[model samples]
Target chain A: MRARFWIVASLGLAAAALLGVALGPVGLSPAAVWAALAGHGDTTTVTIVQAIRLPRVALAALVGAALGMSGAAMQGTLRNGLAEPYLLGVSGGAAVGAVAAIAFHWNTVVGVPLAAFAGAAGAAALVLTIARIAGGRADVRLLLMAGVVVGAFANAAIMVAYATAPPESVRGALWWMMGSVDGAEWQRVTWLAAYVVIGGGALIVWARDLDALALGDDGAAALGVDVERASRRAYLAAALLAASTVAAAGLVGFVGLVVPHMVRAAGLRQYRTLLCGAAIVGAALVISADVVARTVRPPAELPLGAVTALLGVPFFLFQLRRLAARS
Target chain B: MTAAIEFRDARVRYAGAGGLAVAGVTFAAQSGNITAVTGPNGSGKSTLVKALLRRVPLAGGDIAIGGVTLGQMSLRDAARRAAVVPQREEPAFPMTVREYIALGRFPYASVWSTSDPGGDRAVTAAVERAGVGGFLERHTDELSGGEWQRVRIARALAQGGRLLVLDEPTTFLDVGHEMAVFELLAELARDGMGVLLITHQLNLVARFAQHVVLLHAGTIAAQGPPNAVMTGGILERVYDWPLVVARDPAVGAPMLIPLRAPSPVTVHRPMET
Candidate 1:
């Protein structure tokens, strides 16, 4: 029965991806999509499908998958259902790192994602360090508060940088801040794919350890898990996945929070299954949301982050109420 | 001649807003013996088990297992020698009973180890022993409290350790399930496993456990066999209530009875006429 559910879900996500790739204002028919995929379309058609739409779709999948898997690992380790990539300060730290790079115009000298990567790693370290200093391993509440403080600090820093930059750079930062896949090149997708594959693969390997963790730290330790070591490794992996995705796509909030819960609610419980299922569903959700953002106003676009919250807010509210009722 | 576990001057201090919960506690468990720690609610019974397992770091002293200091052994190695079944646990995610039980194999198997028939046999045996063989496929969150407690005990059993430490293992259980758990532990002890059971159910402890340690006010009030330690004086002092301790006529075990306070009478006339 579990296998059958996964098959159905996988098919649904594949169909969503194909549909997202095919549907746009210019409307490539299924035949055109087939031809473009088969590498026999005209130059203009090929550019629209390949250069413009394909990279965007692929980035959506990569970032979405990274967010979902990391979210699962985070929630499992913390033993808190409300845990997410952003709530842990990975996103905020990465954003701080990226904004600092943009403000310094590091992209002109170093590269786009490299600066973003550095910033994200720095932010992750900062959050972990602060969390450790404040409350030890049991200081989960303190860590969450630190995340909020760090996120606010990063956003303020981004605004200050935007205010001081050249007018051209200001528009660039604003666009990036709005989170469009409009100019997603093959480069961002490639790097993100590599990171997710490595990081996601590690999470799957540690799936059983994750199961032990759900039993609370003491219970898990009693079961023979090196509670501290497992937690640290899982946290590091989750941070890497979230940080890389943030570096690629600007802060696409709540995909991490939403996708894992949705998959679990659908009865996917095993870590291997949950991570795989959440990855596909997360990709499908982002790609479809991006399509809506682009088509809602026809050539004009909405921010991808805004679109994510539209899908995320209602589900989050439902979850909160459900949890409240359960407890 | 070898002890399965030994706590020499082991102390656990919870640095709450107030102060410590346990001062200095020392104990030992020999192979093939059922040793229990019994005390009032605030007497640091749980703290003793946590200190032995290194779940909470010791505030002062050292704990050794098989003559090796707990600090010298890795957490995984300590787990191999000792496994703990907590009184209660809440898992964040819903997992199947079998998957939850299989987590006991965490210390035994490596990440890349193959799932062989031998592994399956051990897990099956543990499930049968813990008496949850019928509910392996059910969701853990859906089980009744007693059933959940049994499942956790089963998981600890499956860990295949020589020393088993349990904290109030019978908290949510009724007469039947509680006896069932104690019976299982007693049987395991007969197989040469050292059992350190922390329970508030003094009756069961008096009936089954081979040795007893009574704690009061973060210190050891008394320690010995049930016949020696379940005295009325210790019970009343530790519990802060009037109580009676006598041997049960039917089972030849100790029994406890609390004496309720008398109500104040407004009209004070001597009954003696």
Candidate 2:
């Protein structure tokens, strides 16, 4: 049964990847997509399919999976359904890092991601501090409030930076803040892939610890997981993954917040399965969402972050409503 | 032979607390014995158990499982020596009873390795021993308090450890289930596993526990065999109320009952110097 779930999920992700590569501004047929993938196409066909859409799709899938898997790890450790990267101040923090790089005209390869990592680490610390003050480690309501306050502060700081930036820098910062996959290139994809592998790998490795943590911190300790060490490792890894997503493709919101919950509700209960399942489902979700963003309007590309939240918020509310009815 | 757990003048103080939660308590629980910790609502029985389990820090002195100090032992190492059945704390995820029981095998299995055959055997034996076969596939949240309590015990048993410690394991149980759990603990003790339980149910402790430690205000008020420690005077002294005590008719176990209503009177038993 578990194998079947994985196989189906992986297949869906593959299909979405193919669809993403095929559907863009240049109306490429399936044969054209295959021909481009096979390294045989007109320069125009190859340029659009290989140079533009291919890198975009890869980045989307990688970032989506990172966010989804990180979200699953966060939810499992915190034992709260609402514990997502965006809601935990992770994305807001990463955005600050990326925007700072953009606003200062630092166009180095790794500069923005390192800045994003620092911002994410800082935001995570503040959120944890707030959670601790509210009570013990991470009560759900206090965590949400902390995330919101941090996010609002980050947005305000970003506006202040924008207010003082050059016109070109402001455009770049605004575009990055709103989040887009249009700027994805091979170099960015390679850098983000390394980040995802290291960070996402940590998330997958702590699967059992995450499960034990669902029982509570002290309970996990009694179960033989070094609760403090394990939680720190998990949280930092999640922050790393979330930051990588922003570094690669700005701030793609709602994918992390919604995918893990959807996977759990679909009957994958264990963290091992949930982590892997959420990754595939998340990959598919963003790949398709990116496809819609690029093609829905002719020359004007829709913001990828807006597109995901547009699809995500209604589903999130429906699930919340169902939960309310159940209780 | 399996060794005993020894507490050498152990004390635990939560930060910002006015006094210690469990203070300078020296005691030992040997293998093949049942040790009961009993006290009033605020008497620190729970605190002592938490301290021993290494869930809380010991501000003074030391605890040793077998021969190694608790502080020196890793979390996994400690779990291999002592398995704990904590109070009924619900998991956030809706884990089924079988999956819940499988968590007991966590210490025995690697994170990368799934479907551990030895772990599966332990889980199966624990489920059978704890008698949770009926609700094996049901979600833990769907089970009654007693059913969940039994499953929690089974999970600890699946830890494959010798020392079994429980914190008010029978609080939500009915009379029959409570007795059944005690019998189970007694059976484990007879099989040469050490058993330590913190309980408020005095009558059951008298019948089942071989050694009883009466705690009050972070101190051991009394510690000995039930007959030696469970006197009416001692009960009145600790509980601050008049009480009657007698031996049971069927057995020589101590039987205690309140003899009169309090005039809202209280006892302030002086702390030992």
Best by TM-score: 2
Compose the digit string of candidate 2's lDDT tens values, residues A170-272: 5455555667888688998898899988988877888888888888865677788888788888988888899889877877877887999878777788888
Docking class of 2: medium
| Model 2 stretches with alpha carbons more than 4 Å out | A170-174, A318-327, B1-3, B115-117, B246-252, B258-273
Give RMSD to native, each candidate: 5.1, 3.1
Summarize candidate 2's per-residue lDDT along B228-269 as a digit string, tens digits: 889998988998767889888878788888765654466455
DockQ of each: 0.52, 0.62
Cα misplacement distance, residue B83 of candidate 2 (Å): 0.5
lDDT of 1 by residue, B1-273 (tens): 768878777677775626566777777888798999999887888887777656778888788887888889887788778888875577887788998888787777777553433667778888988889888999987898778888887888777788888998888678888888889889989999899999888988898888899998678899999999998988988887678998888898988987765544543533421
TM-score of each: 0.89, 0.93
**In angstroms, what RMSD does candidate 2 have relative to the true structure?**
3.1
Native-to-model Cα distance after best TM-score fit, residue A98 in candidate 1, in Å: 0.8
TM-score of the second chain, each candidate in turn, equals 0.90, 0.92
Angstrom error at residue A124, model 2: 1.3
